[model samples]
Target: MPSSVTWGLLLLAGLCCLAPATLDEDAIQSASHKFMLNLADTAFSLYHQLVGPSNTTNIFFSPVSIATAFAMLSLGAEGTTRTELLEGLHLYWKEVPEAAIYTGLLNLLHTINEPDSEPWLITGNILFANLSVKFKDEFLKYVWELRHSDVFCLRFRDAKARSKVNDFIEMKIQEQDLDLFEEFDKDTTLVLVDYIVFEGLLEVKFEAETYVSEAFHVDKKTMKRIFMFRRSGQFELLHDEALSSWVLLQHYRGLGPTFLILPDAGKMQHLEAEVSQEHLTRIFHSMAARSASVYLPKVYISGTYDLKATLGGMGITKVFNDGAELSGISEGQPLKLSKALHEARLIIDEIVMDRSGARPSGKHRSNLLTVKFNRPFLVILMDKNFNIPLFLGKMVKPW
Candidate 1:
């Protein structure tokens, strides 16, 4: 039985939300690749800001989706309005041409979201606009070309409009718990909504017989009984000296690799502080295979973020302020982003699929190192192709 574990799950959904291929400036060439770098930059920054220095709330959301959705807005943004939005998203610092950023976003979306690929990660963008305003035909056309989304013109306060929006989201993600829109403001001319739902189904999952419903240590004194799934095999392992944590790498079927970092006792804060792109890449390259037993607590995380405050902290302000510039969306009226809402959830448990031969139930050997996530740890998840963070959070309790 393990005690008090504070874990952070950094899931970077590759709806193009994963980190870029490399953080090294020398490795960057085209703007398309730079798009990924920018995504990683924003992803890490946003996750850090949301979690703060001393906060440990389980946070989950997509940075790629946010950056891409706002990139669309940047198309219509003029002057400082556009500058602030791009800077906040970490999309402007590279001096990459604005058009190239849009192209990179479109390319990343297509790269991860091929028509023939499995739908492990599903995402969408929908614009709810006041019926009175008319978006220019060109803007709508480009949105379709860039975002693969459609716009709906309806009254902001209309209950039916909210229901329709929610209904569409539920249909896309197949999760009933998320699609909830209570009321739209009367002055709400445009509401950009983004949602992503990912269920990681690893190629190899722990069998039912091995699962133990045991008491877990949430802290020094609190104990809670939870289903701790156990597996034994050759897992890629890394002992990061700088962070004082052991990094475990696991693979998802069609998604990407997940890095679970178990910090030394009383080292969770130090690990959070030392998190960076360099450490991530170093771990990916340095982790080596080793025989060990791994224990994972079944986890489910969900949260909603007000992008206004989050992006504001990231240096993206004008769009949400009074003197905003969003006329590009619709010259039909003065447009400023009134609300940028996003939500996401992740569930990790035994997802049993049909198997052929005998499962890899390791032989009881004396040398087998046992790694129980019975204490505080961190989970860094990124989509396979995109290499960005899918879901990010710290959970003392996963419900």
Candidate 2:
């Protein structure tokens, strides 16, 4: 016979496999989409707050990964800590049951993990706890069922233990070569690590022969050289006078599409001020498909953020303090989140094809209008069906 802790972990893993299959497909998707949108809104709000007044630096992050970590942590919270976690995530627990939220998240993981899905998305979550402290069975069950996260019990003070945790994360996202954590504090009681790695090819790829090194304006006076990709096709375009930006939608092989927002001269700040869930949804719906010649630079952007201050700014203060009410995780031991670290990287490259085939006639190219991204712009990689933004950021400088 196994110990109660071992039995609990086994049950948790079993439940994860069974939960999504039992729920109604449509209801699960609907609730999952709503929850993800709410989380994305909160994540973007946090981004704007972190970037501050100086918006010159490039920014990139995985909001879905951050939100998923918090959702898992919320399961062990009690009283004020629980309330703050839920509200901070823009999730209303009263209207949505805890089971539903977990089930919905499971459904989303299933969709993205499908064998045939393009723009392959892979996510991993882990909870590292002190060896002396024992986690409650209920809390472990929720983490496993909701996020399919791996739970590890290790001595934080031990150097080998920290290396083991880092090794596991590296192996999970090895295709992208991401290292999520550099070191763990010896005094740390618990830490949550979440990451997302996405790689996709454009449905209509750029021709390598046409690739040109062009000038990318960092600002009015500064410029940098970058390889620009060109493609001529019908894309959904929106010229929003209110926001003073041009919205262009580009589809990958998968379900979600990436939206590029190029602000008119001197209007970047104005458009950033008006960003919100409602505003993004409105902009997406207002777009109409049109023929255009698009030129965008190939980019590889990566960022690491220590989110403790940002979470505090969003009214999630209690979880990081010593007196935090996390009784659900352990009754006798007082545990609070000591560190919240997030690191994300995105690689956008063209899928160069063989040019042996005949090219389009000259007449075909005459009707296409030109749209060039020579200045700074915002990119939103979102799931079209759910209005969920998997990744969001701005490219201010290529380097």
Best by lDDT: 2
**lDDT for each of the candidates?**
0.69, 0.72
Task: Please write out the lDDT profile of model 2 over residues 59-176, one tens digit for every residue.
Answer: 8887767776786676677778877876886765576544455555556566666777777667777777888778887777767766678878888888787578778777766743
- CA error at residue 20 for candidate 1, angstroms: 28
Q: Backbone collision count in every prediction?
A: 20, 0
- What global local distance difference test value does model 2 have? 0.72
* Candidate 1 lDDT over residue span 73-148, tens digit each: 7777778988887778888755554434655666677765666665366777888778877787656766777667
Clashing pairs in 2: none
lDDT at 99 for candidate 1?
39
State each model's C-alpha RMSD to the native. Answer: 9.6, 5.1
Kindly give the stretch of ten consecutive residues in candidate 2 with the minimal lDDT sum.
Answer: 1-10
Off by over 4 Å in 2: 1-37, 93-99, 160-162, 175-183, 207-209, 351-368
